[model samples]
Target: MCAKQDDAGAPHHHGPGTERDTDGSDRFEVDQEVQHALDRLTLLINAAEALSSTLEVDQGLRRLCRTLVPGLADWCAVDLLDDHGRLRRIVVEHRDADVTAPGLDEGLLPPTEGSAASVARALLGVGPVLLTDFPPPKDEDDPLCLREKQLFERLEADTAVVAPLRARRQVLGVLTLARTRREVRLTEDTLSLVEDLAHRVALAVDNARLHAEAQHTAERLQRSLLPELPTDGPLEVAARYQPASTTARVGGDWYDAFVLPDGAMALIIGDIAGHDLRAAVMMSQTRNMLRGIACDRKEPPGKILARLDAAHHILYPHQTLTCIYALVERLSADEPWLLHYAVAGHPAPLLVTHDGETRFLTGGRSLMLGVEPEVHRPAATDMLPPNSTVLLYTDGLVERREEDLDRGLARLRQHAAALAREPLTTFCDEILEGMAGGGSDDVALITVRTAPPHAGPAVATP
Candidate 1:
């Protein structure tokens, strides 16, 4: 009976050992699965980081090809369709090898005359398309596909996958990958991954193209708005328009000088509110109105602005404008009086004396146009001596966020004083250069100097 009991206990001892072995095997399997998932997640994160860092489309394609091939496929090539719907090979990569030069030029495979590529072109309409089990045409043999098959034969590949890249439903390019049948068969999972990558590439390319187009348009508009400098003049004028640092925010800042009917020169500087197409449109309107008023009215600065204010409400009831308008009349042999200037919520004009002194012409202050119309009061007048220079500009010159307007004014004053003794043209250039260094807001400067009696006629200079 003791021997029987011992035998039963021996089997019970083995039961716990068996349970321990099972638990260890299960834990080992769970750990291996967890590690595989972690590795895949890490690889995806790294690839996404690489894709996001690039702005150049070609460099981005190369990076993408390097990231996908070997890990996802043995070979990969990106084919982009031109504007004419012709497929053009762009980027290509092979496992542990550089791209073959002739392969890129010869590897372009179109819609195979009437196969899946043609069907995709018709159905997708330039958007992303995925082709599975795509075969060459039944009738005439395709030279391109034959070449591709030969290439794949060398790589021992039996399956091919292609995905079109698209943005806003417009096809930008196509991505193709080939894999050996022994390593992996092309499946839905592989197709979905390629689609996602193509989408990202398309978005990046579209953004860059839009940015370039906008810049070109802005530059062309700026050139058209600014008139060429007068042919001959003693008064040299130079103007520069610097766009805002932030992309998509080009504003309206302009300067103008032309002879009035009365033989006096009219100098105008203004800034429109905000930075958009609306601001640019309003700028054009305001400038034309002021020019018309100055030429037709031939009145004092005060009366001209009153007319402008009335026109502003009639034309643009909801918009506003800030301006400094001055009329320079040659009074005597060597003296000029800047008659009847007003500031409608704009920066005061800067006056530089012949003795190298600078002062702000802070005269009458009134509400900006389009706000309310009242009897426009005449601003205070200051006489410009011979060789003296008067500078009129927009408030973007003296308005910084961290610093107060006073500080900006002080900085302008300091620079103006240093340039007071220089030629009016030089002074204007120096002021613009200094302001550009600080920060670029829209800037416009107009400089007019009183001519001496012996200096003869004052011609326009730009």
Candidate 2:
């Protein structure tokens, strides 16, 4: 063997019979190992991204499982310890769609003992467990082992790895990966990689659970802050609050219907400008303030909203919102109802007849509340015949990012007209079902129908 150096003092190692680095099997093996390492690093990066993609627990877990199946294993399963300390299988994802595992559906499994193997041991914080050439449990074996055996046989698993999903020095759950082919077996050497992936999974699951809990709490508080519709009244009323499609943010939409001291029925719908706990808290305060002012004064809807605007400006500066205020009243019980309403930077109130005719109340329009405290707002009145209905709603019901505002308005009109002749309860429900897909924002709507006892659209859903 011989080596020659060029003028640059570097060995060329070219030409026949000259010893070269490329011909050695050791060098080839080293190159293969480097490529394999690079590939594994890429896979791990993808898994992390998939896990953190969504704040939905099951969906995010499914993504992570998908990243593992057929890439690292034939299938994967995730078992989590619930709030009650019970072990529940939340995901069992298999690569082959044709393979059916009878007992592998996500559900509760029997208690895991401290001495159990693999998944159970991992749950007990025993670190990663690798199983090779495993055997199926007998019929009378430990319940947890029996379940695992059933899964193993169904998928024909020859090698498996179970690792604890750990975060903050605590084991939150367990991740299991099973390989059906013996040649592509998982060994103790790969336990480090599997355990590393499990840690990322644990963090994502923890974050998603926290987000869901916060969303539930905020929505519950918002619901509690809302006013209950009057059960005893001549007007049949129904109000609904639909949260946004994603619970990532708290909504500021609200609806209120209450009777004033002077016997006028007050109807209100409003939407504050933010999407956080602050907006929700402000909604409660604003609703209470408006209720008090409406009760204290005998003014029409416009005057009442003007007073509310002034108060909102003084208390919560730089905040803006849209609102509609209306008072339904008449001189006596026998007379027809008169709807005295005012609008402040809100959608027009809809009027639908018993015969399925619909129209938007474009009168009494003014800038939305919180804009001009001293601005003179106007009010409009419309006489409602027996069995007629009036609707007030937030922008969420008729607003889509990609479509024109007029198109959404038209969709609302079409749905409202078709549902007009239906019972009040039916009308409310069907309208929501029909129009909810129009936008992704939070929605709040109030419907008031005038009717005689046992005759008109005042039908209620108990």
Per-residue lDDT value at 307 in model 2 = 95
What's model 1's lDDT at 80?
A: 67
Regions of model 1 farther than 4 Å from truth: 1-202, 229-234, 247-249, 337-339, 421-426, 438-440, 456-462
TM-score for every candidate vs. truth? 0.63, 0.90
lDDT: which candidate is best?
A: 2
| Residue-level lDDT tens digits of model 2 in 347-443 | 9999999888889999898998888899999999998878888989999888888889999899989999998888777887788888875357888
Query: CA lDDT of 434 in candidate 1?
Result: 80
Candidate 1, RMSD to the unseen true structure: 8.9
How many collisions per candidate? 5, 2
TM-score of 1: 0.63
TM-score of 2: 0.90
Query: Tens digits of per-residue lDDT for model 1 on 1-462?
Result: 122236446533336667799899999999998986686566566567666666555666678778877777777777666556666676777775744543543434555344434324432544333334445445455555655545555655566676667889787766677776555776665656666666776776677667767866975675577555443444444455666655443567777888766667777888888777678767877888898888886776777788998988888887888887877776554455554577777888888777778888888667777788775646666777767778887776777777898988888888888887776667877888786554656666777877654675555555
